[model samples]
Target: MHGPLNPESPVAAKVFPSPNHGERKEGRRPDMVILHYTGMASESEALQWLCNPVSQVSAHYFVFEDGRVLQLVPEARRAWHAGRSWWNGEDDTNSASIGIEIANAGHPGGLPPFPDAQIESVIALTKDIATRWRVPAERVLAHSDVAPGRKVDPGEKFPWEVLHEAGVGHWVKPASIQDGRFFSRGDRGMPVEALQAMFAMYGYGIKISGVFDEDTEKVVAAFQRHFRPERIDGVADASTIITLRDLIAKRPAPTAS
Candidate 1:
């Protein structure tokens, strides 16, 4: 059971108490959800590490490869999973988000595809959390999204489209990949600045410096990984640009607007 063994999700069978959590920073209520992959060969090891105090990491939920769901931290408490992360202007994302780590042999294990059963579990769990927390469909994000330079978990093969089809998170038909105008590191100008602004407006921690620096490249790659998984070469190509524009266009309108 989680330290308090409180079950936050109706779909989760039980709490698996992880010691690696603390008070939500400044009494923050989660407004976002961050998904991650354990990146371990086995769920047992990953679970053990997450609860191990030395690991200093935990998530609100953990989904096994076989589809079993477990809560590792109380939903009302801050889980330590998102470390040194940012989204929009919020730096301590852990406090403002619920983290879920899916068990998988990650990119180091050759980027193994997430099992269909596991993905199903993720969709259900995410739907429950997002509904309960009133998290925006677009605010359901990848770990790499909040920590662009440091993380790539729940990588490109995580089947975001499948989740989208399940009515869990935001997604779109990725634009067709083709040769076209593109921006890569070292490119510069108003167009590049505009690209950075778009990414930043969409919550990626990119700077509108006008120079296509490494940070911008990583953020672009992160965007590609989550939004347009067809290609992730750190270049802002036409397909990527078009895809970003589409997502922005489709975002929900404000109540007054």
Candidate 2:
């Protein structure tokens, strides 16, 4: 593909075209926003990798640590992000989501804090993309949300609440952490089934089986990473359960038919 000199979002300072993209599958329009961290020590290296066709990955936009935004692929095209992921019963996430890669050292670099400037840029870019696409607030998600266990970018340290406050994503004040009844792997019963159902209802790709299996643990961890960052032990403590319940209750209503 030829380089795109003009950016799809005004928030983007310029375009840094990447060849790793294709037409949105089945002509599906983007309805979700997926955020990721480049997870490399050097921001330049991360940017280059996204643009490298050999890497087989790319995002619609990339945000630098200094708050500069670059459009890597056009919003109308499907970038090679969110691979092998699922959400709200949709397996082809890339076809229906716009992806943003925020440059950060991520978990490998001890999960460093996102700079204030960088976060501001992320908020501005996300608002632009979501607004233009009419994407729902609840659909703004971390990479882990769609591909739990397989990927965890823009990790727990990412400030989801800040984005929510800026009207960019769904969020709720996490329930306080405390000792109480909790669920963990190896536990199995109707309660486990209920927990799985709640997660599925919230768009998590979890099966409603009565077993708290490894997949359940991973999904719970992903939920914690996005919602309750204070702790992400994979165990469903009272705090996690309550937080999940609150999120579901606050989810935006479906559009009228």
Candidate 3:
């Protein structure tokens, strides 16, 4: 099939179309932006895999370490990223979001730091997409955020505070870690239920079952990966709870009809 002649965002230098995409479901327009890491040994191989039909995985855009941007799947189409994910009760994440895959060695390769140029390009690309789509800042998220335990791309090493500085995503100064009350797997009660409810209200796919289950731990870790990267032990410590509460407080109010 012929690829698009032009890139969707001006930041994208060219169109290197991927075959692994399809029509967005139910005429849904993208309202979220999901960031990811290629997590492959090389950028070329990663791009090739995304464009390969057999891989069945692709994102709307790809960013290289040197800050080069390429468009793989059109924004109007649903790229095969965000599989089996959920956010704010929306299970069809691929249908409601644009995915940007950044080339990096990732966790397997020792969690290398993202280059300044690369992060700049990401900020520019994200800003353009968010502005054009009118996506809320809170809706910009990490792949790990939607899939927890199952996916952790664009890992904690990724500089979210930098993106926030560029006015891309929502962020707040993480509450300092200190010895205090905490919740972890095996713990159960009203506090656990309230913690789960807070996570759910913040759009994380967590169950308010009053038990600190494995799933709850994963969700907490995922939240830390995005918001409070100083520590991500999956334990809902004082810092984590405070940061989550601050984020909830800072969330934008719904627009009136």
Candidate 4:
């Protein structure tokens, strides 16, 4: 953290460096993008808190409501975001992903809608970073996606489809909400195991225990929050299953010879 400010992204006009960051573990280069919402009452307050040393947290970029973008950490450093998070068996999400904190009052503030100006900026920034990093669409993840049961910022209210429309992240039409033979907290058997396997395959931290438990429900809710925002009640309903399967199907194939 030395000389003049350097913007890791072309979209960022300036840098407001946060001290609460470290070198990426073993020089790990980013291959993922993690999106978050400020979740506080005011954008200014959220930005200040992120830069505060006591907060021990910062993202690589912050997208303000008026479409202003600020780079708080260099892409080569491990920003102190993504604390205690896990994804696809990797625990150091901060070191593996470019984190973007979007300005919006999240669940703590009743999940206010993100302004279009801010979302557009996010889309622009994400597309640029994703392209340069060769990040797969499916690797652009929500905060909830990496830390189920521990974090839920950038909640269901966030317009993921809008970002997808702008070619930023992976998205699909949510399975229609309907009544069907669904699994719940009390169910168990081959179906439950199958559900857990599918979720785990999709990078969710779930166990194929053949028993529908609270952890399974939380992971299901996290999956819904990121994939199927139409409903997020932690129930493994048919809609959730179909959505998960569809997402898996749409995932890109490996380029093997």
lDDT, candidate 1, 1-257, per-residue tens: 43456577888888888877778888998989999999888889999999999988889899998899999888888889889888999999999999999998889788988888888889899999888888888889999999996999889988888888888778889999998789998999999999999998888898889999999999999999999988889999999999999988887764331
- Model 4: runs farther than 4 Å from truth? 255-257
TM-score of each: 0.96, 0.97, 0.98, 0.96
What residue runs in model 2 are displaced by over 4 Å at the alpha carbon?
A: 1-4
Q: If both were scored by lDDT, which would come out higher, candidate 3 or candidate 4?
A: 3
Report the lDDT tens digits of candidate 2 across residue range 16-118.
Answer: 9999999898999999999999999999999999999899999999999999999999888999999999999899999999999999999899999999999
CA shift of 219, model 2, Å: 0.3
User: How many collisions per candidate?
Assistant: 2, 0, 0, 0
Clashing pairs in 3: none
Native-to-model Cα distance after best TM-score fit, residue 140 in candidate 1, in Å: 0.6
The models' CA-based lDDT, in order, is: 0.89, 0.94, 0.94, 0.89
lDDT of 3 by residue, 100-176 (tens): 99999899899999999999999999999999998899999999999999998899999999899989999999999
- Tens-place lDDT digits, model 4, residues 142-185: 99999998889789988999988888777888889898889999
Q: Model 1: how large is the Cα RMSD against the reference?
A: 1.8
